[model samples]
Target chain A: MTNTEFIKSLSEKTGMTAEQLEPMVAQFIGAFARELASGRVVSVQGFGNFESREKAERKMYNPTTKSYKIIPKKVTLNFKMSATLKDKINS
Target chain B: MSDKVTLQSVAESFSRACGVPKKVAEQLARAFFDTVVDGLSNDESVKIDGLGTFRVVEVASRESINVTNGERIVIAGYKKVNFIPEDGLLVSNLVSDMPDVREDVVADDEETDVSNDTDETDIEETSEVDDETEDVSEDITTSEDEEPIDAVEAEVNMVEVPEKVEVQEDEFSGIDMLICTPESVEEIRLELEQARADAERKLIAAKEAHREVLRLEALLDKMEKSMVPECAEEEQTPETEAEPVPAMVAESVAKENLTIYEDIPSVAKEESAVETADEGQKAEEVAQTPVEPVEESLETVETPSVVETAEDENVTVNLEATTEEPSSEQEESTDVAPAEEDTKSAAEEAVQSTDAEVKQEDVTAEGAEENKDAQAEALNRLLSDKSAATPEPVRKKKDDGHYWIWILTPILVILIFGVSVVMYKAHSDKEKTELKQLPVEPKNHATPVKKQAPVVKPKVETDSIQSNTNVPAETTATEPAKSKAADNKSTAKPKTYILQRDETLTKVSRKFYGTKDSVRAIIRANKFKDPDNVPYGTEVILP
Candidate 1:
């Protein structure tokens, strides 16, 4: 979602005024998400983890068209479920 | 599919999609989060069945290990907890089934789609149940060709109904074989409808409850962040604005539903998504409710029953705030409206009026000072004149010159003409005697003058009253005090006197000083001896 869209959605979900919500969201995201963007792992006891990893840039050949192209290196957020969560889900 | 949703992005998107301002959306998201925290804090299972559950886990206190060094550390025993999303079920459900749902449902749906590829296919079968009644019959006919439920149960410990299948005829008549009956179909349909209705109601209640929790959480957060620590209050307090929003919305929706039930169409998945977003907003307001203690101190001066003093104070504060704000605003507007001459004229006029009131105050101060100086000079002249003229019988002296001009001159001219010397001396002597006698009759003449003074005072007072009508009553109070003091002094003079006979000391003293006790004072002043015997003919001076 775009920043504005996300803000609107959050307001709808939370019923908070946009004036009050903006700084809070900014602060929360600024604190925890940056580390993840830099390929750091965030692990909580029960909740999932947000981690970032660097994928090696590689060239791949298309099977049908016989075309070769390079895939750019990108960072991705990977989530891992806690054991408690896994148990709850299985149950 | 479920792409990475940063909290920031979600806050922003939620704001945009819900038509709420960005800041409010973020706070709402936080509030919802804090509500989950509170739920976990209290050890309540915050369950969003499809999404995730948040609960407090009683982690036994144990020694910790430093991951890098592999060193164990002492840990304390306490219950710790965390928030876990049931994948996307809770979050998506919060959005789903609610009108005005956020578009974030798409993210949730994509993830769940990948994880359970069969779920969507199952939904298709379930959704087709209403249309597949006859098809179910046909399947029953086909399944008759196969082994019955007992045979199936023998192979499996428990029969798990795949999404669409239902065991309609489970009751056995006499034989071990389970038989299908029309009554079973009717029961199944009834059961299905009842379950769907129950789910819808539960969803509604859950949405409302969640909204309330969220609103309270938001309020708590606000209070925690507020400058005044006292503003924070215990959660779940009613009588707050946050508490009522969801209730009001619920009431309004309930009322609307009652009237327009037929106008509404069948619920769709997309519609449910929108409803979830709407419900989230209500939840946020609920979370925000607990912080409303601050409102009581807002001192809404508009209350009709409010005392006049409070109203006046509030008005004064408002007036000051208004003045402060407008002056800066005025300056800005004036700068911008440089080309608008009329606007500039009006602005200047307002400024001029304010300055004029200040100038008026200065003028009033100067006027009062000048009046005091004029009154002081008049009083000094009156006092000095009285002191200077006391020794001389000044009234008679001033009249003597006037007599010569009128009477003596006329007589002298007659005498020079040698017309009647005797008559002229007699008339002239008579006039002289009359002039001498005039100063002695002070009381007889002063009565008319005293009476006239009272008359003149009333006229002066009336004139002042007419001229200074616009002046405040407080300003005119001093005028009456001055007039009354003058009248009081005039009426306070000693009125009785006595004459002495045969040079008696007491009689003589009483005649001079208007009091008999002055006789001894006179003896002391004159150093008289034998006061009763020698003083009889000695012409003793009266005190």
Candidate 2:
């Protein structure tokens, strides 16, 4: 669903207006990114976790070039869905 | 701690997590499970957004064997609920920090976020101490709001009930750390202490192993150093005395080594061996012979050696000749068998008495070197006794000749035992000095030229004995009359001697003169009274 449509549906279901949910959703997304960038794992209950993890630098072989190249290390963001969330979607 | 997670427990946990009464949560949980079952039964897929998906897929009709009954059955087609987790949710729930596909996806998401907008970044690190402590006491199977710690925003979403513990029927992961109980804190402290102690013990063991290795290396080095010196000594021997040794010289060296190693008093053992051999020979030689003839033969054996010894005028040679003659007589007697053993016994007694005399002389020779004068005197007295007897001392000389042969073995044993090497060494040195006097072509040998010095003595003695044997053989070559005449001629001059107990006139005659004819003469004088029997202690006058 589009953001607006989902907001209206959630407002109807919980007896809350789109205005309240809109800010809450914004805050949720913003806080998740902030926590993740800060290296804190943002574990959304029954949904998924957002986190940044270290990716170690290593040598990668290129078959076409017939040589090795260093793949630079980096901090990457991760999203892991909670088991409850996964089970709910399939059910 | 409970083995399984059930729906009721999850519902209770959910109820507590959401601040709802447990009955409402239980009813809701039942309805949710009922709806999922119904959807799967209708061949539809059900999705619970925050949880997971459950889909029913067709089960094809097939034959299967029943294990219980060994029967095959074709069951009708059916649908099975196939749940495929979305976004790898199942991977996130396992207990340890086992980075599954969930972590990989999270890492990807992290990268994507940073790439999109990198401003809201942090460098926060989780405390390893908290990680270690929480790892213990995690098996209680309770669900608290684990999302509250890391993300402040996530905590607002979880409505938690205080003073209520929901022992949930679901697995959770590292994100959860309970509000620390005093008991759990104590357990954590103990576990940390144990881990630290283990690390320290391992460090000590490693250090000890290193020290032991070093000690072993030092011991190996010392052994190698010690072995090197032995090799050097072996190497030095070739450089110092590089010459081939003669067999005789080698034998001499071995004898020296034997003397050093055995350290037994070899002379006594040698003497006993020689005496036993001589006794065996004499027992037969004097067989059926009266005592007088034996004394005659024994004297003859001693006479030649005494003359040879006196002619040399050497005390040492006198001793050796005296020692040698008894063995020669023993050797001669070894040839005769005791046809009449009574005379043989009497002969043995005479031989033993002579042996005692020889042994006394040997003892004198063995006395101190300063007592050589006494030894020479004793030997001279023995010599005088042989010459003074009017008749030939052929029998005594025979005994002495027997002794010479017997004495050789013990001499060789002692020479090869000790003195042989010393004599051989001296001979070798003399040969080296008189190289021109030596035969030049014997260079392959290490023997000395003057090796002939001691070697000639045996040949000389053997020649004398051979000539002596030749004289007897020549005399016996004639008819029996000439041999008897020769015997009479040899026994013509004799001295008077007393007869002992068991002395027949024949025995007395042989003891005094080495003849049996005197028995006839003595009986004629006694007028044939007890003709065969002559009583003991008779002073028989020699005819």
Candidate 3:
């Protein structure tokens, strides 16, 4: 769904305007990103969990070029769906 | 953040960030998630900027086995929510925070950077300090140069300071290069020289051992040949006497000496002859009836001893008498000779004694026959004992041969193994020296022409040492000396290295040139098919 439609739906549910909810949503996302970046698991009770996982550096071979390149280490954000959310989506 | 951050913490943080009431912030956070879930459920996907895309992917129905039972089952298709973070938002934040989370990994990168920075700073600081010292010295000189006489000394002092600094810089660069390459090369060369010396020593010891074994074998062969003739001489008398006695005795003794004489005719010949003569005289006195039998026995025994003695004395005369016996026996009768003469005489005496005692005692004749039979049995027993004694020497000779064979086999095997070990060591040493020389050759070539003269001297010295240690490796040694002379005029030659455990082509190249840029050159020079997975201890040539 588009960000506006989602924000519009969130504002309606919270009895707040989209303009007010937009800043609140931004703050919420920033906090979530900050929590995940800090290597903590962020759990939204009925929704899902967000976590950061470390990816180690690895060598990659390009067969066409006949060359090897080392891919740098990185950290990636991962999401795991809560059982309740999974059931809700399936149902 | 806590180990687990719940929606309440997010709301609290959001409230702290936006100056909203806690309850309002909590409501907004709850509403935000609720809307995202609603969007996901309706549209099957949701894209949140600065967050991520939440896509509901349809998983296909597939066959599976029940874990608890041996039964096939199918899993019904369902949607799985997959989250993909927005480009650079989460990653950038996580990466920025990564140093705090994982310090060890970051420390490595930092250490390398710190080392390089420290090196540059150290050089700059030294130069700055030198400059400061120069300035201080110049000021002191200027202060001292109030006298015209001291002014010339100040100029000399001024000239000396910059020269010292320049010389120190040159020393630093030279020390750095020595630390990087030349010292390791020298250490490897020393190791190679030590190994070559050890291998040459082993080769010398092995060659000495081989020569010793050869000398021992030659001595053994000479001893064996010398012994063979003596053995043959000792065995000859018994063999010849045994051969004719059996033939003569078998015909005349009526099988009386058949078993005994056949086994040991040579041993009993003389003894049997004397016993038969005495018995013949007894038969002559008893009745003269058994005289013929006694005489026949006498002649049979006497012929072998006489023939053996004659053959021992003169082989040609024995052979002539043997051929003359059948023809001349009747002309010279009653006297026992060595062949048919003895038989004919015995027959004539039997005729004469039978005519003389034809009517004398019959009982005495029977008794003499019984006595002859008994004596023959005793001679057979004695002959059996002699036959048993004869082969013991032969068996001993055979056992000696076997013993020698057993002794020599292990020595030969040990010689083979030792020689092989020495050869293998020499081969390995040659390769090691060659590999070691490759690096030195390149260094020599890389050096300026003026330094080449000194480098050539060491090469010649090593070659002379090789020649002194191993004559066979002299050719190989001289080739390198010649090549080193040629290398003085050429570009740097490729050096060879055996990759150590956990070492790679890049590591070798880095070791040679202080940079990994020459890895491609090394691989090309060596024609490495698999540059990434080269086995350890593989010889690589560094260009």
In lDDT terms, which candidate is top?
3
- Tens-digit lDDT string for candidate 2 (A7-40): 5655555455778655443322222232333455
lDDT of each: 0.37, 0.38, 0.52
Best by DockQ: 3
State how far residue B390 of model 2 sits from its true place (Å).
99
C-alpha RMSD in Å of predicted model 3 compared with the true structure: 45.8
Cα lDDT tens digits for candidate 2, B423-505 = 88999999887886565455335222223223566553433333323433232222222233334434333334355655577
Model 2 TM-score relative to the real fold? 0.20
Off by over 4 Å in 2: A1-91, B66-71, B98-543
Q: Give the C-alpha lDDT of model 2.
A: 0.38
Q: What is the lDDT, from 0 to 100, of the residue A18 in candidate 1?
A: 69
Candidate No. with top TM-score: 3
**Candidates ranked by DockQ, best first?**
3, 1, 2
**Runs in model 3 with CA error above 4 Å?**
A64-66, B95-543
Query: Per-residue CA lDDT of candidate 3, range B423-509, in tens?
Result: 999999999999998877776654243234355786554443333234222223233433443333122223556677777787666
Q: How many residue pairs clash in each candidate?
A: 62, 86, 0
lDDT of 2 at A88: 47
